[model samples]
Target: MAIRLRVLLALGCALLTAGCASGSEMTFRQDKRLTIVSPGTGKTVRLPVKVSWTMRDFTAVRAGSPVRAGTGYYAIFLDKYPMAPGKSLGSLVTNGDCAGVSGCPDAAYLAQHLNVFVTSGTSYTIDAVPSSGTLGSSSHYLTIILVDGAGRRIGDSSWTTSFTVAGAAS
Candidate 1:
């Protein structure tokens, strides 16, 4: 009976491990130019931005570009969560928290047809504030990436910042 129990346990463990490893790990790159500004406190932190990407079962791909998926077939996801440690995540998707880890994801964010409150071409301008009108924490991190059906990485982005929370209205 013990032998049978051990065999069952081993099989269960194997299945779990296989499931976790089924997804291919993506590669990430970073841009050195990063700027984070705080409002009331008037503080700013300068840092770098990193990006991750994954692709799988792509129907087509541009040279040196991410593989492509047919319409309604699949879509690329950018981890809006920082994917970095000590980073906080928000329901608003303004921050990411899966940093420095592989296969461990926080939230899957779609890069298509999503609202990006940014001034620059592709950056989002986050404007979250506290009701007190008092300046508090500053900025949040966001992850951006692309992938194909084959679960291979194409590209991505990452950044962290501090911002002053707004105070209550007068």
Candidate 2:
């Protein structure tokens, strides 16, 4: 048991050292508040609704998804790290040079169709943690969608806004 513990400790230290030397491939972006869904469950109390949708890289946004002057780009979701070529959609932590995701849990969204109030307020702490390199400092199009636990669209209202990943010049 002691030997095993030492091996694990050494491995963890080695991984951290490697990451520091590799330089950060992520960054931190301001949280763009959005709407979501939540409910009081019997056991879990408040359950958070899952998010769904696709990311339309600004360069590929079609005319239908044109960027309006006043309206900003959409911030679909979090977790865009691709193990190979694709990406994951979830929240993460990071720091300088590290990529920052735009979406957030504790954010206010425009109440259009469904009541945004149903989404119990959450507090997302932006910390320097591991993240999939999905979002970065760039002008792109994002589409935010709300879904139920079973992966079903809840509201008719979705977001298509223009946004910029405020980061250092790359």
Candidate 3:
């Protein structure tokens, strides 16, 4: 009877392990690319512009409290300069906790000047209108980047394009 009980326990453990092993393995690649689809470079457009884009290889997943592998989100940097491609964007620090971080701005500052967070999607269309009275007619640079589950930047960092806000002084 004891031998039978031990066999049953061992079988259960093996089944659990086998079940886990059957799931798809995580794969990593360095060839992911992001391309802006609308707002042709240097094109003049009005406010509340529609921005669209496409991505390859990367998977978009809702960001949870705990980040998961191969799943993350995207951020749009409007009119903000971009870091060099492949450079690391360290921890995402907001105004509430900008201590010791150079160039760190608070949440309100970012919200007004930067769209630090956007929803996760393989392809997305965003209605981008600068907050009322926030931006004058001017040429602005837009950049898109992929951030991993851990809030770390992945893929090329300098994927940027530019467009002019119609009527904004060039």
Tens digits of per-residue lDDT for model 2 on 1-170? 99999999999999888867433665434333443322111112211223322333222221123333322222233322111111111222222222453432222321221122212113222222112223443332233543332222333335443333334243
Question: What's the CA error at residue 121 for candidate 3, in Å?
Answer: 2.6
CA-only RMSD, every prediction: 14.5, 20.0, 15.3
Total backbone collisions, model 3: 3
Worst 10 residues of 2 by lDDT: 38-47
Q: How far is 108's C-alpha from truth in model 3 (Å)? A: 8.8
Tell me the spans in candidate 3 whose CA falls farther than 4 Å from its real position: 1-32, 65-69, 82-110, 122-137
Instruction: Give every collision pair in model 3.
Output: 95-106, 95-107, 137-168
Candidates sorted by lDDT, best first: 3, 1, 2
Candidate lDDT scores, in order, read 0.32, 0.31, 0.59
Q: Write the residue-wise lDDT of candidate 1 on 1-170 in tens digits.
A: 99999999999999888857433473445544333222212334232222222233323332223334431111222223322322222223333543555532322332322322111123333333322322333343333332233333333333333333223243
Positional deviation of residue 62's Cα in model 2 after best superposition, in angstroms: 33
TM-score of each: 0.25, 0.22, 0.56
Ranking by TM-score: 3, 1, 2
TM-score of 3: 0.56
In candidate 3, position 71 carries an lDDT of 64
TM-score result, candidate 1? 0.25
